[model samples]
Target: MMTTYLERASHALALVCRVVAGIALVALLAVTIADVSTRYLYRLTEGAIALRVTGSVELVSYLMLCSLLAAMAANVEKSQVVVEAFSHGLAPAIKNRLHGVYLLGFAALGLVLFLGLVDSAQSAAGHGEVTQDLRLPMSPIYYAAAALSLLLGVRSLIEALLGALFGRDAEVSHGE
Candidate 1:
């Protein structure tokens, strides 16, 4: 019963991350279009409109960061890529064990990234870092990314455990 609840919660969290990623993608597209249009109009009118979107580069960078971070959980859960070239001839049980090891390694990497981001966030906060044009605090973005990294780590670890215990069957059933 507890495992079922945890699985549900994990699924919900992954769904939320996917939704946020979609929203971030839309925002990124809109911002890029607006920035391009503004630049084009400014060039065409010879600065008559005076409508160049300031801080557009910074905004796009933030949007991209957010989009990537938000997508991590779902991407980790989904196993979007499969390299069967080497593992194709391997026994099913061996392949599953190797996959489990791979997931565990991924989890470890995510944990390292999460720790690095936390340190970066703290350093940014201490230094009062801000974007050049918008003066947006950099620490918050770092912290958000850190949170997502932690989530990805946890999800990866969970998937690794399941893969180890139930092999490929677990992954197929859990959509991992």
Candidate 2:
């Protein structure tokens, strides 16, 4: 019963990650297109593209950052690579306990990374760095990406923990 619930919840979260990744990719593409078009228009005219492309071009970095984070989340949710050779040889009970311990360690590591990201965001904000033309703060975007990465790490930890506690949804094989 608990396994069923956890699997369903994990599936739902994975779906959400897919949607977010798709949206971020689309947004990045649109921004890139705009940047290109503006640059071309400026080339056709005088060398006045700086005014049109300055601030908007800078946003490309943020958009790309977002896309990468979203894609990473989706990947982690859907398919995580692991070396199963050792686990396959282990007894079922031992395998479950080992998996549980691994997930707990990963969760602890994620917590540390989350704290570091938060601190970095705070330090960046305190420094008051702004975009060249738009004067928009960059810390927010960094923090958002960091938060997404943290969420992905946490979600993976949860999935692993659940699988370790309950029997995994998939059949276990001694062979690859």
Residue lDDT tens for model 2, 80-128: 3446877768776666556655555555655676777788788779998
Return the top candidate by TM-score.
Answer: 1
Please estimate how well model 2 matches the true structure, expressed as its whole-model Cα lDDT. 0.65
Write model 1 residue lDDT over 47-83, tens digit each, in one string: 9987877888888898888788778766674663557
Q: Which pairs of residues have clashing backbones in candidate 1?
A: none
Cα error, candidate 2, residue 36 (Å): 1.2
lDDT (Cα atoms) of all candidates against the true structure: 0.78, 0.65
Best by lDDT: 1
Model 1 worst lDDT window (10 residues): 165-174
TM-score of each prediction = 0.85, 0.71
